[model samples]
Target: QGVKVSGKTVTIGAATTHYDVSTDEKLRKACPALAHMASLIGDPAVRHRGTIGGSIANNDPAADYPAALLALGATIITNKREIAADKFFKGLFETALKEGEIITAVSFTAPAKAAYQKFRNPASRYAIVGVFVTKGKDGVRAAVTGAGEDGVFRSKEIEAALAKNFDAAALGGLKVPAKGLMSDIHASADYRANLIAVMAKRAVAAANA
Candidate 1:
């Protein structure tokens, strides 16, 4: 329920709500992109009610946090052990958390630049395709949510493009293959695929802004 800033690291308590995350002045200054992403999540009620830990523990494929965490190289701290974002998320509604282990906190080092973008579903505000891009200590990472059948994942193509140019123009002609993406009533696989590229480009532009 608290946000703590320690030099280069920011640690958010598990019970912290989306509203808190979005509004924290320290967080907004240290990680504007993450705060911006929190600001855009759900409506007022949902944001007020949704805790960061609950959201990530559930690991919803359309969830916004996972993409941001993954791209940011966040660490998921639990009562038992710590898990890297790269290995924390397994698939839809899945995580590396062992039975009875509860998430205690999440922490990440602020990146040089980062941003998140999503094409939302009008009814639920869930991302039809969400992208979080970052240029940080680990280099470039672009993670996608709401599109993968296996759940949130990094877009290697987007990473390579951004690493090369670090601009929206870098994604020009880049095509996200529909093969592993979702095809539900909300959107077809191809549409979500395209949105991945579009949102990634938009996120990069936003980060640069």
Candidate 2:
């Protein structure tokens, strides 16, 4: 399955086991940078078979796809209808995808610049605070995942700062609130909050580079 956005429609295809890149060549062709970026998602087995459609459909709060999808302003395309990435993700392991709604594809306008930074838990390799930043014609958007205890979220504070100045130095003085972040044996809420800043800075540096 894949997602494609055209005009106001965001279409999501149903997930399947097949690992044919040809089926979703449009996604890679349209966004080569993102395609090159996708190669870094996981190990060989994951890249060979793991589907973007499957990833988005799952909407795992700790997964990396949701944050990049949201930050890129991609649309979630389903048989039922198109949903904005911002609206598609509702909460932890939750999305607006209704019953029987199959995601066909996702569409993105391509960012002027974009970058993703993740601090992984050694054991799980899951992001403690994954930050995806995109600078586009509209402005800069920062989507954060894996940090919220309740669900994935956007860092408006970071977005605001980046919008004003798209640089790491711009966020130097900003603070990420520890309230509402995740805490568990792997990491504490404060740790995650601190990572948000660290990852944000790294993401900015990467984008700039």
lDDT of each: 0.94, 0.77
Candidate 1 ranges beyond 4 A from true positions: none
Cα displacement (angstroms), candidate 2, residue 146, comes to: 0.9
* Runs in model 2 lying further than 4 Å from the true structure: 1-33
Task: Encode model 1's per-residue lDDT on 132-205: one tens digit a residue.
Answer: 99998779999999999999999989998878679999899889899999999999999998889889889999
Estimate, for each residue in 1-209, the C-alpha lDDT of model 2 and write its tens digit.
45464643333354532233333565454443355445556566776777778877788878887888888888877777888888988887888988888887777786777888888777656677789888988899898888997677889999998887999999998799999898988789998888999999998888888
What lDDT score goes with residue 152 in model 1?
98
Pick by lDDT: which candidate is best?
Answer: 1
Error of 2 at 3 (Å): 9.4
Number of clashing residue pairs in every model?
Answer: 0, 18
Question: How many clashes in candidate 2?
Answer: 18
